[model samples]
Target: MLNTQWRVLFVFIVLLIASALIANHLTGRVFNYHDPIGSVRAIYEDIKTKIEMAEESELTAIKTIAAPSLSAKTAMQKHLPQADTTRCVDVSLGKVKYKRNGNIYTWTDSNGVPHFSDEKPDFEAATLDTDFVEPLDYFELTLHAANLPPSFTEELRIKLNTVFKVYGQIIGVDALKKVRLNLTVFATRRSYEQAIKLRGADPTNTDGMYFHSTNSALINYRNEQSAMRTAVHEAVHAVNKAILGSTPRWLNEGLAEYFEYTKNSMQLVSVEPHPGWVNNKRVAQSVFTINWLIGLDDTWQTGDDTKLYASSWAAIYFMMDSNKGKQFLKSIMLAEQKSPCSKLTAAELKNMLYQHFPQLDKDYRQWLKTPFRKQSF
Candidate 1:
């Protein structure tokens, strides 16, 4: 929506420039007796004023329709008082439920895999290090929490940073330099549910969600690893809302699941598919054809079927693995952001697939037969 408004403003600016040029050309011929400079100045000012009003009206409509709460409206208004491109406000971390004590603990488990915890470890070898706190301005993502363990918070911050880095590289870092996505994580499901209720959204059976109006992702801290995955998933939504306006549900959710796993390496610098940590093999085998997957009516609104999730990941995975695929995905993302008021028809989607992947049908079959490999990056 924001991107649409800016595009509108850009058109207005171009029109203004053309108008000025025409006015200058006509002034001498139409009114030779009068001062041409003064007439052009008046015309320019009038056009500028009208453009500003149009921009304001568009913003007002967005505020009334899109912002779900009074707080959200107020925040949008405060941050976006005008249509200044460089002054746009990307998303920021909104709420933190727990206070920071500035402490971090390091310990090793029985398997010798090292772990960090906010609480002091029972192991005599555990060490407390208060010196290595994550600075607030050090990264592109901010993690807000409620009663979360400091160690877990630190882990989330680190992992989410890696997620952002990997995602930025995949999508092109220059495209995302303007986004600052935020994630609000709660220590318990009870707190997470309560927060969503207060915000006027149904939690339903969802473990995580990203609110565009509020510009933040929310998650409940369940099992540490699972919670991190949830956080990464929702973070994808937040980033998409900021950078791409609105995305198709398949691409949105697939990209989230793609980044939800921890492969013991934070540096995922390549496009090779991670041996997806999610249990999606059965679904992939069932929905073997890309045509069958895209044939499902209303692909954008398809609900949380395991088959849908697996197929979505497969589609994105296939796209991201090659340079041509990455470029196509990038073009789609830019197009989606540029068009907030338009909807892509089914025929249009099919044509787009063929344009980008001429051999999609044959290639997809080959992809299904190939064994999934754990990513080296």
Candidate 2:
């Protein structure tokens, strides 16, 4: 009986130890069974992992939702008629008529000088040539304006005509006979920002924008200093899109920057120094190379906005400043006409530049180093 009890006790002890070890092994997979604090830390880490995955999923969903809007914009841009420089001049249509704003009477005096006023001027009825003038057909302008001088819009119209004539002469092409343009001149800056937001564009650090979706240019008269320059800058974009058809971003913005500081007097176009590029020469040499500039798709893409503008403006300045450069410009534009919808590769464009001016890379840098006196095209 004593020997039987001893065996039973030994067996019971052995079984209890085995059971305890089994429980510890199962709990060890997650955490130490003896450590409550370790279990709490493990639970926290698991929750953190789950939360991180959820956040990643949410970000992915947001991106997916935003992608279609970008695609739609691309499609709309593609839908536009992409005309080349060669045929841009040849598509001259009928002249546009002035759709005058409220109480706006426009007429030329006996001396053939044009005039416009909100208050009716004391002029003979026969001198009223409002019905006959057709300059508006070339530049279709819609003005959402108030409390502005009647002369403001009229003067703007005349200036835009000068722009057409001068750029036409520069490129050796006739100006398009019709271009539909919308200019919204808000009375206050608040109204302008609100308008930009409504169009789904950021209004920070900008006074104006040419919205592709709306096919309109927006500006405000609150800061009158940069208003006209901004207007002409954005207008050039609209005209380029209509005439040149998807001009390369470097060239497009370069041209806009070139013309923004224009002195259009007596039907002549003269370009002044660009504010973004002119004074920042040393920085430009360090930041830009001809090959790099040509490769850039847009300043926004690289987040190199200022240097990009500076480089582009410098490039255009160098091109228009010299006879060979003008020849090069003409050659580029002519070559681009052949492939309107297709953009030339960086290597292809670089090769073309070298073909025209074998030392263009060196020449461009030299021009930027020296202070340019005049860049008139």
For candidate 2, give the lDDT of residue 109. 76
Q: In candidate 2, what are the lDDT values of residues 2-82, reduced to their tens digit?
A: 999999989866755554454455434344547745555565566667679999889877865765333331221111111
- Pairs of residues clashing in candidate 2: 95-137, 96-136, 96-137
Tell me the whole-model lDDT of each prediction, alpha carbons only.
Answer: 0.59, 0.62
Which pairs clash inside model 1?
97-145, 97-146, 98-147
Worst 10 contiguous positions by lDDT, candidate 1: 75-84
In the range 299-375, model 1's lDDT, one tens digit per residue, is 32223254566677787777766677777777677676566334354466667778878998888777666765544
Leading candidate by lDDT: 2
Q: Candidate 2, residue 74: CA error in Å?
A: 28
lDDT of 2 at 137: 53
TM accuracy, model 1: 0.55
- Show how many residue pairs clash in every candidate, following the order shown: 3, 3
